[model samples]
Target chain A: ATERPEALLLVMPTDHAIPDVDAFRAAVAAGVPRAVAGQIVTFGVRPDRPETGYGWIEVRGAPVDGVAQRVERFVEKPELARAEAMLAEGRYLWNAGIFLVSAKTLVAAVTAHAPDLIEPVGEAVAEARGDLDFLRLSEGPWSGVRDISIDFAVMEKAANIEVIPLGTAWSDLGDWNAVWRENGGGIVTQGAVTAIDCEGSLLRSEVGGQHVVGIGLQDLVVVAMPDAVLVADRARSQDVKTAVAQLKAKAVRQAEVFPRDHRPWGWFETLALADRFQVKRIVVKPGAALSLQSHVHRAEHWIVVSGTAQVTVGEDVKLLTENQSVYVPLGAVHRLANPGKVPVVLIEVQTGAYLGEDDIIRYEDIYARGDEQGPKR
Target chain B: ATERPEALLLVMPTDHAIPDVDAFRAAVAAGVPRAVAGQIVTFGVRPDRPETGYGWIEVRGAPVDGVAQRVERFVEKPELARAEAMLAEGRYLWNAGIFLVSAKTLVAAVTAHAPDLIEPVGEAVAEARGDLDFLRLSEGPWSGVRDISIDFAVMEKAANIEVIPLGTAWSDLGDWNAVWRENGGGIVTQGAVTAIDCEGSLLRSEVGGQHVVGIGLQDLVVVAMPDAVLVADRARSQDVKTAVAQLKAKAVRQAEVFPRDHRPWGWFETLALADRFQVKRIVVKPGAALSLQSHVHRAEHWIVVSGTAQVTVGEDVKLLTENQSVYVPLGAVHRLANPGKVPVVLIEVQTGAYLGEDDIIRYEDIYARGDEQGPKR
Candidate 1:
């Protein structure tokens, strides 16, 4: 078989388990050159427990040559003692859900091992199209392909697979506890926390959450998101998916999603809200402009607290400096900008009947937000 | 034989206890007048501890036919158990080291009790002088009174003695922890604190005179003063005196003093320091001016980051606004003022052989500080 010039690197992030980025980058680079030598190099992440949530791979034989070996068998999640024994012996590597192989090599190995995965994937890539920064696979073959992981279709049965043991710092940041561990002091932990006789515990505070004071605690993680809070042991953080699903089932917005997200323009956050009123702080970057939009149900008031703001309201255009305020009635077209070389800080208060973000109708946008159906106000 | 219409209120504060003014005011209004009943009223404060570091009160009964009780005994500190018993007994109140008694009552009681304290204190107050709103007691009698508390000569000897319990918030500001608690958040706890699983533990975070990060903490009472930190139990905050004595015997500032104090006009604080450089944030209120002073060992750079400032360097006078900076060479007469209505914030960076608060040689005075015995820088 002829080897293709390009290689395919398939990566599967198993929840956020890596604790350091430098180690992960080093591990990824360690096997890159070997995979380029026509050998299938795979990183087998050893399972920390007999976790049924993740698929597993079993090593069946020794190295094929200098770079690769054949897989004897692949298993779903195994029982506890079996997993322990597999770890005791030196031959098994947990399915890392990651693969690195030349395109020709992967196709050839899968063909000899599990040919079902190749046809649809090949057909989809052959008809692939480009859209902006992403490659769009053809719908017919892409959707027709069975929803299966590479571990189940190829690595478990392939005859030329090799495992590379990686001791690296990595994390998927999949849950709140993992996020809290990595971001303890970077964000706000307000009001007061008393930690005594504890280590490796991550605690976060929200603006109006309960006054949390940890005393004689160890390795505990506490997070105060918007309306919901989480307190868990770090080792049990993987169960956060179950927690998030429960929250979704109960219709808790705070547990399912974050209230604020950064955007290219700047940032907007709702400080407080009621049925008839909503308050928001909008920070626009220097020389950035917002969309020319109008709210069907709301009247708005903009107060400038710092820097300078350029405002376009209906037919009038004005330059508002610090302490100055402006008003826009319902259905009035308006837009805001930072004309100078400094950030424009402004507070926006809206009064409306149905104060939902979807009430906004954008006439024009500078950040191409019109294409994506974003929440509006 | 005759019942006089006077008594003295003696309050003795413990180690570094800063009294809370509002709470004391509330307590006095609610408890004092009725207890006084237009007769002599005195407060007897029990000293929490004693090792000769603070003045002590010797108590005895006053002699009278119908109204006076004879003082049979007097003694200094008797040890820890004695102090604890004094606190537990219903008859004793903490010697808060403060008093509120009519002039007539104190004079008569002192004459009948110690008989020696009356003349000196009377003569001193009679010849009392005033300077810049402070009552300067005459050195002759004021200094001659042996610096004894009123408890020894007045409260203990009186036949009819009554104590209006001060249940209000009172802090003597005995140390940095007291200051931090009185000035900031309202939570306190103790033990070997590991600020995991929590937020806001006002800990004594100074380690060998270095401040450490209380991760996952907020609104904490951290008392990292000059050289030590006493991470005490918040609820058992009354025990701070024990910690202070422990630090004071070791000659550490963290237990004894704060890094900064507020003057009537403004405030100054040491922000950071190195072996060769030091930084301070100085504030001057509206119409307030710093003394015209010069340093022999260090030059200073002043940056005006907020409000407006009138800066004097040698013979030159200039107005500095936000973002403007000035330089003062060593031995140059320098003064700063807030010419505007708002407070002026100035940052001072010093570089020289020595940078201490006592390095100043004042040529002019604004707050009468030029004549006072200055600190050792």
Candidate 2:
């Protein structure tokens, strides 16, 4: 279906940031000839510190082809003493999780080492369906495939795996500490953050009109979101998921969902929520139409603030430009659409005794979300 | 004025908190007889620590009447070693800032020691006027009185003075550290606050519906208000005034004012502010009426959420119950009042090109604020 290359294909995680792209390209190029000769190539970074957080790759002998060394084994994350001992020796390298191999070579190695995964994955891919522009894999076959990483299934068992040394500025931003290291290891701040006498800290505010301040803080991480805030030690940044899990156990909506809801058309955010009334700021993308819907418990008033909106209420249809407004009475079927070439922004004030989002009954939906009642746009 | 006591009058700063009221009363009672016998009395507490924040009172002679000692001198706040040495001497006590003296004795002492203050203070009191329930001092003579403490103007030069020891648990609460101590010396939190692995910190959130989380924090002070937030080291809590002064220099409104505006009737807070529209939640106490006013550049929509509202729009007057609404067009005279026995709560949505609070022209007001142009109720 596409221009398939014969020499090598490189795979790298999107999270790793390599500052020297030219040096990385040279390292990948050095492994291309060896990979084309049926040797599975994995890049390894020379250990600069005794970092126990990373896995290690041990090289057995000198480079067989002057650039790639024969990998002896891939070791799991080790203790401090073990990592220090490996760092004292010159043969250990941090596993960079980068692979360079031909398509045929990967298929052959998976067939030999992880024979159970290839058939189900291939069947799922062959039966994948296209939705708009995204390809969704078949659920049944994909769920049947074993969940395992390439290191556990292929690289650990393959006999001809080679290691290429990568000597460039790189970092895997796995936690707030790593992010601080990537950002020069002093004080990193963003968005309405004020710091005084702070050292080695990260303070971030993602809320629109809120502020975060830190004073005399050392080795701390403070993150402020709109609905929730997080403060943790730099060493405990990996335990942020525990806080999220705690919130989930309490059924806190802010744990997983943001105040702003993004959809295919555009986005909408709640401005205020009251007992019997609610306010929202909604933006509709150009040529996007909401579903024809009716609510038995609520009535809505929409005021256009930006582009024009095509509004249909009951039997009447009208175009509302900036500064114009329309009202939908309870039990009235209505549809809102943006027919212009720009986004339409409006403020919606809904009033009712029961104003939950599940009160809506959709008759037609363009984004195929009529049956799914999780959130309303 | 009706029941003047012949015994001593006790004066203490309102900010100081003494936990053992019984012991304090007993100490005051001990000084009453001495004070009635024509000696001015001052209380002193034995130093529990080498506290440099308070002035020291040095005693010279033993108890004259078995409970009070003759006073010697008052020393300014001392350096560390001086305070420690004074503590070790056992003759110096921390000034408790309490004074007790008979009215006639105080008059005689002031006449002899601070002759200049007696005349103007007497004239100001003689010419004071009664306004409603308050006695207002005459401005001219009151302003002429010198700004000097009683210790400097009278007590230092008085011949018959006595010092009494009073042992009790007390706190000045001069700064956040003192407040922390008053709260029992560990993490003290109020409102919606969550803490993890925090020690000796104070985290407070005064705003409703806002969460303040502190993790791995030690000796930190964090205060969150609706419109502003403050974070500072516990050691530098006394320097928080500098931050407020800096904000004042920048003309930040949050430095001196809160988001909620308190009125004589009740209070109101802004819910949302936009380019040409603003929303406010207003509460009115029973039997409270707003001014008859009109806006030049805005219109308002009032929706009653609780109780009843007596609304006057232009020439029409009506009583709106819960869930009822009314609209006031621009330049239309209007007034809102709570006529029921219960409080009234309403949401006001104002739409205009210029939505400043100063756009109102008041014709009549029951609160006698027609001539004053300030925040409107």
Model 2 misplacement above 4 A: A1-49, A55-76, A80-168, A249-252, A270-280, A289-305, A309-336, A346-363, A373-377, B1-174, B205-211, B250-253, B270-280, B289-337, B346-377
Worst lDDT run of 10 residues, candidate 2 chain B, spans B1-10
For residues A1-377, what per-residue lDDT tens digits would candidate 2 score against the true structure? 12454647788987888888888988888998999898999988878899888889999853332279888988888999999999988888889889899878888889999999999998898888654445767777999999999999999999989998886767877777788778887899987677767888888877554556666777888777655566667887776667667667766566667778877678887666777777777899899888899999988877676789999999999999765677788899999999999999887777788877779889888876675546564
Q: TM-score, chain A, per candidate?
A: 0.69, 0.80
Q: Candidate 2 on B247-304: residue-level lDDT in tens? A: 6676656566767887766778776677777777789889988889999998777777
lDDT of 1 by residue, B1-377 (tens): 12444443534445534355665565455435534553343333344333222223323432111121122233354576665564444334443445455546555667888887767877887877654446767767787886665666566667645444445444456544455555564434332223333343455433121212233444434443332222333443444555445446655444445656566558776554544455566788888787788999887767665689999998999999764667787788998888899998766656666877789898877555555675622
Best by DockQ: 2
- DockQ (C-alpha based) per candidate is 0.02, 0.26
Against the reference, the lDDT scores of all candidates come to: 0.58, 0.79
Per-candidate RMSD, Å: 13.0, 6.4
